[model samples]
Target: MLWLDVTHRPGQAPWVRLMGRYLLPPCKQRWHTCAAFLPQGGLLVCGDRRGSLLLFPCSSSPGWAVESAGIADGGTSPVSEDTGSGSEPSCLSHKGALPLEAPLSVLFGLHGKMGVTSVTCHEGYIYSTGRDGSFHQLRLQGQQLEVLRKHRPCKGLQWIEELRFTPDGDLLVLGFHADNFVVWSSRTGENLHCIPCGGGHRSWSYCSNASAEAFAFVKCGDVMLYHREAEPCEQRVLLESLHGREIACVRRLGAVEVPGHTTLNIFVTGSEDTTACVLALSERSRAAMPLTRLSDHISSVRALALASPVGVFGLLEAARKLVLVAESFHHQRCVLKVEAFLHTWAGGERHLLCSAATDGSIAFWDITSPITDATDALHRAEGEIQPLGGCSCQRLCSASRGRPRWWLLCSLPPSTTFFHVPDLAELDCWEVAEAGGELRYYCVLCGRGLEMLHGIAPPESPLLGAPQ
Candidate 1:
């Protein structure tokens, strides 16, 4: 394990520097499963796949002396690094020196053959769960751990994987028995609910209050939600697992009329499972049917762009890298240092693109010409606008006025900015029609939600100052 020092300066991002690292013993198979830090003592408790708990004292900061250290129980010694001369035992190593230390204590075979899945601390005691269908409450004594109590297997739970406490001070045990996922309450020592989720190898979450409880899990690649309250319990399928996991992004591509059927809205969705799909939505029944899936990407698809007649652009997530693909012309171009692609629109006779960067700057680009085999169609942007650090550009929409005006949503302060399109002159007031064709002047901003007020007039003075 490694530790680092974090430094944060005013008006600057935080910086993390490496402090020190601990070295594990050689010739030992230590497949760690869970770990937690002690609240009172400067110690770290770790559990391994071998059902063993190891405790290491982190009392000393960096720059400690180096020496050969053996396990307190005389079982194994800390691993030794091979210097030019010979091998020497080392427990912890500083940034500039080779200082090593061994674990303070090691308790072997606490859970028999099954591995420890989780370890957590509450109050002054530590609780651990194992795949052996049981959990144990432990306390620290000097450098060793003493078992305070052992809990029996929850009802209908044969293989315990996790243990959590509810807000109402009840212990919650989650595991799998037979072919179902089970949740048991320690306060009543009874099974709270059982869901036929195939097994416990998938992702799951549970939350409960005094009045209601909700459990969500994945089965057969589909997300399922189970809510239990005073009334009859409800269970429903949230999203199908066709993409295998949660979808990342979705955009409406407009509507199409099916033969003999109602009109359907066409949408493109990108998923974390590394695929993009085209789906048809029936507004009448509120159902989405997948039409086709694109499996060309090997990474999670985070963003998508559609250029009709040209092609679809699927963005595979990567740090600070942007690539635009024009499928119809079979051309791929790299955009240097562009952070996020916000919105794209057609302006008179030119195609325009807006993008924001991590450094709080926005840019407008023109890509009107068609892509060719020899050159990319991207042209120099009209200008760049550098804003305050906390400014987050949400959505941009054009006004229907004769003189082009644009509305920009700055979500940080929950306000709107209006300006002329090309020249970007700050405007005091402007009118824009919503998607449903209602004219609205000012946007009533709530926390993460927007309500367009039609009769409300814009402020007499500009909402934002001129960009410098």
Candidate 2:
């Protein structure tokens, strides 16, 4: 139960053979399954075909296998001596492998008859959906599985397809397989409300704001936004038709509070037509307004991310006020450009900006160092995106999942890779997608087309907190 790198090609014998008792499917079980990793890195919860859930933990690191491999000859599996002729029997020599140190240990198992479809891990508990249309919450008490609560103790709803946990609260949104979606309170197990998401789940992609109070889901190129409210009218805040083209991606760029001034939510939508539209959501009126449309790349923009705020610009304005203290401060310079930052986001600890360009190169910027004077500010005003560090990641598109761990995903292999939030280093990565063919070594991943909204830092305003 460790993640080992089998350095062998596909359709080939595994390099390290663990020969002891391993956990396999119980005899003959179905295969339609779903899984989610627990917050703690080692454990993984998986739904099985026999309508059971299993918790599996990694017993060792593949790196450890790599180290022990030397003691085991690593991968020099002895093949039959060919005898240099076609009439020779080949003898197998077992010299390169040892059994896995620890067999797959089943920490918790919920055995049943129906198949489990979806599973998600929350603050402390585990939620799952089964083919029986039932939802269950399980907690690992010691070595046993404890069923804390089960929604629809009798009959369940239509097969639930999608599950989303609100970012800021204890709300779980479940999308049904055939009809509308429901919002449930994971805290109290109450079905808070229901939203009509077109037809069960077809082509709609959903996104929500930080609080999860506001949500937008697109269906067949048309976008609809819904927010939680006491009345019906306020529930449907936006409904826009895209006329024809499908939406490639959409994101909540960033949220900024102007300190006793205004708080705005930024959103960017990239479509298939090689264009992106930036929109703003105002908290005062709970309304979404279109801001600007960006069209520069001839190809479809694939990803988006948000970077740190341009707080350095404030220094230029601040320096302007010190003119009276200088005797010969006579002239000033001004520059403007018509370039467009169509796909943008600020993340990676609010200091790194990422964007996926059409030329197959992903760019990253260091936004942590704010400009102190008008000189640096003028340098950036020339419409050129001067990335702090630039590398070529041949990806079509990508998007930033936004703050905390400013995760950026692209279409290339190692599909999910991230920069260290604080240092922007390419150290940690997650390869979550199902493997299709021979997995090969990959280049560093880069790309994003979404806007990164303001981070969770307190707004330090020279304009608001200054001496009047």
- The number of the candidate with the highest TM-score is 1
Error of 2 at 99 (Å): 4.2
Please identify model 1 stretches exceeding 4 Å from their true place.
Answer: 3-14, 23-29, 59-98, 167-169, 230-468
Please, what are the lDDT tens digits per residue for candidate 2 over residues 196-230? 77645454445555445654677778887777544
**lDDT per prediction?**
0.56, 0.45
Best-performing candidate as measured by lDDT: 1
- How does candidate 2 score on lDDT? 0.45
Question: What TM value does model 2 have?
Answer: 0.31
Off by over 4 Å in 2: 1-22, 30-32, 39-42, 63-112, 153-156, 180-205, 210-468
